[model samples]
Target: MSKNKIITVQNVTVTISSEELDDYICITDIAGVKSDQSRSADIIRNWLRNRSTLEYLSVWEQLYNPKFKVFESEHFKKQAGLLTFTPSVSEWIEQTGAVGLYVKRGRFGGTYAHKDIAFEFASAISPTFKLYLIKEFQRLKEEENSKERLEWTAKRFLSKNNYLIQTDAVKNYLIPKSNYKDNLEWLAYAKEADILNVALFGFTAKAWRDANPEMAGKSNVRDFATVNELTVLSNLETHNAQMIREGRDKKERFTILKDIAEYQLDILNEAEKIKIEEKEETEETV
Candidate 1:
């Protein structure tokens, strides 16, 4: 990856920008890896000069898309080796009704093609580079997974903190007293636990407990949450507690926690936005 970790593949950034796709394909680095280039334009031009390259692109388009235009393709065939050759990924795409090559510009711009076309483009660039890109891409995925796991774990820890709060309350107010044997102390302990539960889970553990009271003593709310949800709740509780200690207003804490939860959930839900964008790009170029 370059300092900016941005590569110009076929004159576009290695990353695909969502704004560019509309009746055109964008090419992306197959691996989301980036590199600096000394005259990337020259590298692209050389690929265009290779007749086999054109045929490969043509075949890719034909196999994946039925509406590809042969008329423009024929023109490229005639002009392939001439000194005046000026075909570009974009030009080829436009002329041949391609759905696979995207010519994009600006920040986060890239020639992001579908993975199929992107791999072909990468192979054309440098087989070794393509291999490196794939390796790096796999590494990126692993890193992402690791980050998500760590986040989830952190969330579970936060949830446990809530349980700890309830336990501490029990020790302080419910235990070591004659009331330990009284239903009143038990009710008070349950009430405070319910508050922490509602704060973290948007409902009381007792609500869950009441709904399935049979499972109450054996399991708690956090234990049942999907890792992603637990992580978000944990984050929320930690932040909310900080706000409380800091004397921040309750209104501000609620809003901020809501934003945090929603943002994380969005990332979880749309983890494949980049991949999906690339896939759509390939379809256009094809």
Candidate 2:
């Protein structure tokens, strides 16, 4: 579990955890919608004891969990649907090594099931509730994806603005100092821009276009860059401009900018990893 997000279906607030790439929905909360809060555990256990539920769980575990205990699952399958065969979430995990469901304890504590299983479990609550849950979940994911695209667009805009700063430095400081004629001065700006491109992306604009001819007219390399790459590119543009002002040669500036790009990208990647780990820990405690 990472951070917890919520969706309300028929006034029932259900918690969701985006665990890695999969979404885990709080089945305990779903149970509350079917019965009183105190009977949620019993409701879940009753569902778990159903033979059809056991068959579905066994198939899911076999498909996704290499470490799943098949023999233990078989033992449970034989007992499923019996009056004395109630199983708790923790017991199932311990015996079968299942990853489809997990019991988290704390303020937001509950049994969370992977979206596939949660949707199945929701049917046991009510077909109407299950349909609403699926609809709301899809809406939440689409909203998140849209937000991510918006952030990427904002970063791309920032990178373009910084590129203008870099070009201005070349026009004011580097071009006039060179022997280029009036009409050919544009080459100096192009060369300076390529220096940063080579340092960060290991290719010139023309080289990238030649390599991806299909995307040449529609988008450049920067348009396809990751958020971290765009961030480092933005920084490199500023640094390259300052270097040009200091009268650094193209070769020397490229070398320094490449080193900075590598170092900053490494730091940013590691920071992102740490942030995810910290979020998971915080969610577990909560």
Candidate 3:
């Protein structure tokens, strides 16, 4: 058998009863073992002979099974409560368009029907058992949802943390050495900062200006960036300046930039948990 994707709703052991029929069958989790080795034919035959059960089954078939033969169902209904009524799942399905009826043969066999049909069949087992199946299924879903939320939260927080680290690095290095002779020297410093801006935002100050000619005078990128990205930018500015003073090789600078990018990616992933905790606290207060 292929690996079964077990679905637990309430507490039901949901599995494909038969892939050929595409049936979703639910059984009680507490049921010791499911076996059809016994003399089940007689028991099954007797169950099908019941008048009320026959009516219910036929009604269900008519509702869901478009191929059900009303003519055969009429014949079965007439003999349902009569003197002697013998019925088999195969016989019923063959005669009428019944979605379910247990069978003993065939490859994609051993009782199979659609999910809705299977849920209805579960009633034949026990009502409380069906409820348990649903409950367990719901619990599984909630757990999966929680896991996904946590992952997203962690990524955001990591991004925020790395941003702060980079910012602090900048404050230590670049901010202390501000001196200029003319507007051009100041422009050079501004241009250097724009390298960090380009790596992060894909735009330089001058490019932003040319694009938005009307709003050319103001700083556009600073306002739009997240707190974390800005922090990283500051750190980069300071580090780059320090490296320039030491006359570091181009290869060394490039290597540092690569490391910083990887570090930022790692922190973004880590930030998810922090984000989730904060959200939970806010929710509790609200």
Candidate 4:
């Protein structure tokens, strides 16, 4: 089930459900702010019947939803504002291939729309309510962004620390063995980094960029790695450094590093599973 959050705008509580791409706010709850809870459906229907509302919604669908049926939307647009014409959430969805609005039916059921559409609906209900809704939504996003930055910083610190360990080993062990000129010694360090990347991530740094040209503008592949992958990469860095000091061949080191990466990831995943199961059991008991 998707996690749900409640945000109060001008003393009226509205529910927002999270999904993969965007948050969906309960439009019916917003409707209740202008009318009684019993009249939410009536108010929504009346709003949907307005020609202006249909035009605005059609523009939104065209901009975001590629599969939006232009023919069907045009048909609805012409029928709008007629005395006999009335529209409902389900009827609109039936005509248009829009994932923008969802009619959830259960204990916490309501007419939910994507944040973009919901904010527009809020503006129609009351400008004051719309302002507060945007304010609360921004507050939620800022909190989430802050938390994510802190986690990324922590993992990056771990990766950098292991990098220092690896570099020190290169200076003490690999440099003397290779007997390379001062200007060419940096190549060995770059080669050592690739060894770890290939062993753990199955791609060299250059190879990753070649495959993801769009992402290359913003970051390298490691920057988008999962927490588990970062952890394994950090471990591999230290282990590769030690292996270098022991004078292991590249083929032998790659084989050992790959096995270690797999083993450590399995262990980490198992531990995470146990923690989740324990938390769920506690919640059920409570």
Which ranges in model 1 have alpha carbons more than 4 Å from their true place?
1-38, 142-286
lDDT of 3 by residue, 252-286 (tens): 55447546744774585469668979999999999
* Clash totals in order: 23, 0, 30, 0
Residue lDDT tens for model 1, 68-138: 89777878887888888967677877778886666666754555565555666677666876666556555
The sequence of per-residue lDDT tens digits that candidate 2 reaches over residues 1-286 is 3889989999999999987436899999999987888899999999999889999999998877767899999888899878889999899999999999999999778999999999999999999999999999999999998997898688677765655555554423321122222223333456766777666766667766776677689877676565678889879987887775455666677778889998998998899889999999999999
Stronger candidate by TM-score (2 vs 4): 2
Q: What TM-score would candidate 3 get against the native?
A: 0.38
CA RMSD of each candidate after superposition? 20.6, 20.1, 22.0, 18.9
CA lDDT, every model vs. true structure = 0.57, 0.81, 0.54, 0.77
Q: Quote the positional error of residue 120 for candidate 2 in Å.
A: 0.2
- The TM-score obtained by model 2 is 0.59
Tell me how far the alpha carbon of residue 264 in candidate 1 is from the true structure, in angstroms, after superposition. Answer: 29
Off by over 4 Å in 3: 1-3, 7-14, 17-23, 26-42, 101-109, 137-286
By lDDT rank, best first, the candidates go 2, 4, 1, 3
Q: Pick the candidate with the highest TM-score.
A: 2
Provide the TM-score for each candidate, comma-separated.
0.40, 0.59, 0.38, 0.58
How well does candidate 4 score on lDDT at residue 172?
Answer: 37
Total clashes in model 2, counting residue pairs 3 or more apart in sequence or in different chains: 0
